[model samples]
Target chain A: MTQAVATNDRATTFDVAAVRADFPILARNVHKKPLVYLDNAASSQKPRQVIEAVDQYYRRHNANVHRGLHTLSDEATAAYEAAREKVRGFINAAEIAEVIFTKGTTEAINLVAASYGRAHLSAGDEVLITYMEHHSNIVPWQMICEQTGAVLRVCPINERGELLLDAFEKLLSDKTRVVAFNHISNALGTVNPVKKMVKMAHAVGAVTVVDGAQAVPHQRIDVRDLDCDFYAFSGHKMFAPTGIGILYGKRYLLEQMPPYQGGGDMIKTVSFEKTVYNELPSKFEAGTPIIAGAVGLGAAVDYLERVGLDAVSAYEHSLLEYGDQRLKSVPGLRMIGDAVDKTSVFSFVMEGAHPHDIGTILSHTGVAVRTGHHCTEPLMKFFKVPGTVRASLAFYNTREEIDQLVDGLAKVREMLL
Target chain B: MNAAAPDLQDLYRRTIKGQAALFSQRRPPAIVTHRCEGSNPNCGDHLALALHLEDVAIAALGFEGESCLICRASAVMMADTLAGATVAQAHEFSRRLDAFLHDGQPLPGPLATTRCLEGVRAYPSRLSCALLPWQTLTRCIQPDPTYATTHLEAKP
Candidate 1:
């Protein structure tokens, strides 16, 4: 909402060209045209620094962490643990012990559902989640509820794709055990007021789990300030590698919850009679972790710190505004989400062309976009659309790319209509 | 069908455009012998196919639902071509069409309207759109146990 810092026809706070240079894939062409990637909500392009870090780990420090006493093992273990510290600082978690690594955001949420939800929720209990949540967030709770005999309640969203806080409050009851929702809607880009929602859940004596997969790349997150019991996010969404993510849970809660899975590294000691579990984060991290992925994520955090999230956020907001205005000019193009607080995601449907058709057309022009329900099937039903062509932006994206996207859509209209 | 020539026109040729535009005017039969819904869950396309069988011959064929251009066009052209075909003949045509789309073979005769769709053979990802209706029609006649539910997918 604030004025974008621009000087001499350039965004002063952020330089998109420089950011693009750091990502090697941005230089490549798709279908003989320069690639205009707008699918950051699914996964962001990795920076050269992050890529090098992962490569370096594999080249020099490749070893299974935490067990071997060799020099390579020590370096790998140090880098992997240091990545945990970076994540703890990234979200401002209370302690390093609260940060546990998993495969990705989906696995992180599943971990919480399998452990916390199963242990606490029982018959007649409730798990409240927003309708706009990705299936990863929704289905895990559904599984937990099905197992515990607890009811799963959904908070409604308006036509604008904004969650109805009033409905969320009403859904909260004495038996409400957990409240889980996305910090930003991946399909719609609606930014939920998670802090206020977490407080409301706390009022009902319920713990909150925030899906920060889409939010972490766009804004600076302070988990302690939001006071959510659990926060899950993906590394791939934040310029880190796939198959690596973080789950930040309150120590007191994690201490009581059972381990998500049983495996080698999670055990403290083994005997013929019984096996004692490891402490804190190690208890939750069952198998050998993605050491190289953690190292890559650490480098990505360093890159973001140098670029500054505040500047990145401001530049992206301006781009979102420009994209929204340009997309509105395309005749018969209906924008799906118009939440007041939104990121640089434009989901729309042309009058005659289906989203898949539009996406296929755009792909020819090297304008990559996502076309589907985006795993938010319930939200699609609410909007009365089968799916939408979603163009999600990142800080490295420029205004010219958005112009190309609008031009591509015009071509789609000509061909299909 | 060359991947090197990745043109949008190749996929949305004139034939496909015309068929997609003409789909709305075609009406569904008043009565149906067998009906099933086919969906590409990845892209949220829905195709509801119905058949009217008169002594194992397709007396009338109709469909209702929404999908991408390739899918709509394929469904419309398929219904128009297969109306009077027997169950076995319809399946045979579908088999040949599948072979053509997948193996890059020549499209079979009696499927003249769908020939222009040979362009879709290049775009592997969009191939499912062109095959959705035919697959649904197969389910309608054969009645696979997997597709017994309203929703039918190419794979289990």
Candidate 2:
């Protein structure tokens, strides 16, 4: 942060050092050098609050949820359901019943594709997705389409990795039954205009499914304002425990869709001849559920709110600008994504060095960067490169770490070139 | 069980870089008796091994790919060591290399630049990159041409 004109005084005074202290892993040293973690997009490091919350749960409140009349079971069930309520408020969902926990974003999307798409989609219908979608977003639609005889259409993006809105609009038709797209691309940090896209999808009588896995950490999410039918995000990427995610759906649509899985938790009554399903959220939640994960996610929501997402966004936006200028200083480095509204991702490819080799050299310097297509093979194919070296930033990431990354890139040039 | 990460200098030695760069300079064989594509989907490493087998020995060996330095270097070293070697000897080398990488067995005698890749064993992740081409070599020497992928152990 050599220079940053903060939008507000609160934004100006983002104590990154204090924020860094909350994450215990920040003190680590990798390969004899201080750690410079830039792989935030893959998975974020958990804070002490989140860790302690999970610890306290297992230590004190360990029991199966949503069943039993014992005190421990009641406390566990109340804590689990309270986590759902916390999520409902965190994403600004219309109702607590709209939140359904899954293994992660992948399972969240699969629930929509399998339960909703399998029932609503049919042969001769079309499902439109963007080329920049992660495999989680693309593969589920592909499988659902293949099973239902529906057509899968991919909307193209420009060279700078921004969505081609004109092309996206042209691709949307009345036959578009489902529209799936990511809120923010993980590989490239290009932020899609989901509000406008969701409106466009509504105009065509299609449902909007947003992959908000990368968005939830960087910015505040208002599912009610986005008005998307389904929004899926993973807790692990947002500084929570793994195997817990939120799928926020409209209540009416969730009522229409069938149960995603069948087990004790999802059923109201069971019979050999016929079985009735439970209400809104539990119908989709089929198993005993990731209770500890949900508890950790709840505490994570508390942590994010206490930190204030607005200040975090502003701080990261400045870091993004700083990183853009700093990484461009490295010779032979070409940035892969240069979207205007993007935040917290720096993807680039250096000449004469493969991404993995760059990654290896960077790792030695304790600058952990991700190399490869990042599960977005189509995006890599579109960029006409094998893969890009992605150094995704977070709110806790400082400009000094960006300098470390640049120095590591210089080391890469020295050795690999 | 490498307790410490491999040093960068030890991992990306001049031998590895020179072999990888030399592969870039040389072109794959125009025609070959056996050719197979090797792929590592985890890191998007794709390599092709083209060989000309005569009777039982490999007459010529060539490669083409944009894989990482470790992978390309390993592929070139395999080609250089196996040229004019019998198919059975190639299989033996492949087995020895796999065992060396996975089980820390000793590298067989008379290897030129292959010993430079010993640093890869410390990097459990990059071990797949070093083995991608050898795995492709194993599949290429077979009677059937199958697409090869990087794995520590050969599939039965």
Candidate 3:
């Protein structure tokens, strides 16, 4: 909030320096040191384009969207709906109607659990998820399970934090009415084979819900190609503002499920006897939505498109490789997840220090890293750790910043070990 | 502003580090007499205290948990000082430790090693870590205590 927006796009191939310039917070200092922010999985820093979009929306078209006789209302409605279209195009969803806006990934997942799982699940039925899911993906299904008397089954992960695909398939019986799992682990950075898993779940007549919160920021996501029945992701994790997220459900599924909440925009007609519901997305989005957040997300999708996801993915892969190799210089620091495929997260633990101590030491060095269970308490239990220090990288992060993290780890060793 | 690195070096003194090292050795008793478990839900620091009470007086104390050095140090040092104190003295120690951390009050003789944690008062976020054990010890003396939590704000 303290920085200015500068659209400094130097034309180069995956130029991280130019990319970093677009985000002003990267230029600041924390604790008198150049801030090395590696907490992207928690929520990514926003770019100038996204910030300008939200600013322009409030400045020019500050009005409630959907229906009004005024000009500002019409402009707001067009921009808000245009934002939805941008999101639909970004994820390559088949129809804009399939994209519904919610608060965040948590709300999107809960909407599916409340609307779909509540209607479909019954006593003695099963809802399957992996051990690596965040509490957002886990607790919603548990609530629905408690409501419907359905059993919640967890597909186990291996020691490397990779989902056991064989065990995931074994857990998918005909009784499993819903299957929910993250496309990538926020805590461990293990990228699950979602397309393969979705196919396996569909083979057993179960619909799959993919938590794409961690994946959307790192790679290109084609909902049609992945063929997940429902894909959920947040805007803030992809360089946009918070309070806006997208849930891309199959048209047939969205049409079949009832409304998650009953309010103004969701209803076509309300009488003392009965009320007629509205169309696809509006039927799900019940209230006055986060219009400015949607506009910011739209601009974010544009920025990512202009930058190109393939370039971002390849560059971040190189960064991940460099970080993995460089972090080995730290003594007594061991990685928690050793999956064959990983994104930008480096979750680790030091030998003699607790993660909170490591986190405080890192903070003192002006390096921002998340240190906790990351809302994956069951996964932490599986790994036999209280918590792990997670340094989740973004494309804007440079190799020099990673070296600073290593230096900070040395300070932690000097003080704690 | 740049004094943090040196301040941290000064904070984790020998007494704090030595007492924190004792945290792992301070295990739960096999007899399961007067043992209490508590946790800081914010950072997942679990603390279990085992104490021996001899007719309204404390005879022995030990702790087992994974927390920061400040927390482990506070728990271990408190256990060491309050080992043979009466029940009222244990409560007094807890109250005085709260005062020292919050209001900068000077600690008495047996709690002299606890002075190493004076730096903790500057970081309010770390206060719960230092207070987790004392609160749990308070629960051990309570007749019907279920769980423990550290509330850092001004209480009504």
Candidate 4:
């Protein structure tokens, strides 16, 4: 792959300082030191562009959308719809009707489980998921399976955290009604072969649902290209606000499924006797949606587009490699999840210090890494670790910050050991 | 780096770090009668407490699982302090530890070494780590001699 050459040379081209300038939080000191936010897997620091977009919405165009005929309502509706269009284009979904707004990836997954899985799955049906899935992905399927009297099957990962495709193939059967998996593992940073997996799942007549929460930030996602039935992602991880996310489902599928939540907007006409559901996108968005959050997400999309995701992806690849090289110097630091095609995440355990101690120590030096199972408790159990100290990178992150992380880890070792 | 920033030494006191490193003092007995598991959902700190009780007294106690330095150190220190103590005394000790951490009450005489954990109160997020062991203890000895206060009384 040209990944190595492209990233090494593209380093000079990707101006990180310029990107860093756009994020105000990066300038703030954590404790007494410059904030080196390595917890992008959990959430990303928002750019001023997104912050101002939300601010502008509240300051100028604050109104309830879709219902009101006032000027403010019209503007709010226009902006919110514009955000949906942006999201639709961002994921290259088949139609705007397929994009549904929800609270976040967790809720999006739950919606699909409650609506689609409930209707389709039954006793003797199987729901397939991976060992590396976040709790959001795993628990929803479990809840749905439990409700439907369906069985849950897990595709196991190898020692290096790569999905055993052969094992996954073996598990897929005619009884497999749904296959849910993560495009990129939040805990392990393993980039699953989505297209191949989707093809295999389709062979067994299993509809595919991808948890793209961690993938969307590091790579461009095209739901149509992957041929997955449903793609779920969170806005906050992609530099948008919390409490806003998107679920891209195929038009034909969403047309058949019932509304997830029964509320004001999800219904076209409701009476005591009968209730008619709204169309595809509106059917799922039950209540007054996160309007300002949508605007912020649109601005975040605009900012990422301006930077060019190709450059961002390439830059992060180099950063990940550089981080790997630098962290080798940290004696007794055991790297977890070294999958071949992983993205910008490093989960590790130190010999002497606990992951929490490492996190606590590193934060003192202003390196904000995540510690624990990363909402993937099953994966952590598979790896035989209590939890891990994870440093997940973004395009705004610099090599210098990685160096700082390494230094901080060395200090953590010294203090803890 | 800002000079005003809190030092790691403040959180990682020598005694606590030493306790975490040794961990030898925390070992399960040959026969564990009571077992309780506690987990901190936020940071994924999990711990299992095992109590080998003889006639309502803690004959031996130990823990196994993954947790933070504060939690591990606290668990190690806890095992040392509660060995041979009756279930009633164990409950009393938990209340005193809770009061000491939350309400600034003096630690019982036996657990003076655990005072090093007081440093964790400054880092509110780490307080749960320090309390997981105690909470697991409360969960282990239930119904008969309940601890007066909850594990995380202040909800740090």
Which candidate achieves the best TM-score against the true structure? 2
Give the per-residue lDDT of model 3 (tens digit) for B25-79. 7666454458787777656788888888888888777877677787898887887
Per-residue lDDT over A178-237 for candidate 4, one digit per residue giving the tens place of the 0 to 100 score: 999999999889999999999999998999999999999888888888999999999999
lDDT of each: 0.88, 0.88, 0.87, 0.86
Candidate 4 falls in which docking quality class? acceptable
Write model 2 residue lDDT over A307-400, tens digit each, in one string: 8998888889889989999989899999998998897899999999999889988888889989888989899999999988999998889888
Q: Which candidate would rank higher by DockQ, 2 or 3?
A: 2
| Tens digits of per-residue lDDT for model 2, B35-151 | 889888768899877888889988888888779999888888887888789988988998888788878788888464687887777667788898888889888878886888774
Candidate 2: lDDT of A1?
Answer: 23
Share of real interface contacts recovered by each model?
0.64, 0.55, 0.48, 0.59
Estimate TM-scores for all models. Answer: 0.95, 0.96, 0.92, 0.93
Task: Please list all clashing residue pairs in model 3, or write none if there are none.
Answer: none
DockQ (model 3, Cα)? 0.38
Model 3, A60-141: lDDT tens per residue?
9989988797999999999999999999999999989999999999999999999998889999999999999999999999
Interface RMSD of structure candidate 2 (Å): 5.7
**1 or 3: which has the higher lDDT?**
1
DockQ of 1: 0.50
lDDT of 3 at A305: 94
Q: After superposition, how far is residue A179 of candidate 2 from its true place, in Å?
A: 0.5
- Superposed model 4: Cα runs more than 4 Å off: A1-12, B1-6, B10-13, B30-33, B52-59, B84-86, B103-110, B144-156
| Model 1 C-alpha lDDT per residue in residues A387-414, reported as the tens digit of each score | 9999999998988999999999988877
The C-alpha interface RMSD of every prediction is 4.1, 5.7, 6.1, 4.8
How high a TM-score does candidate 1 get?
0.95
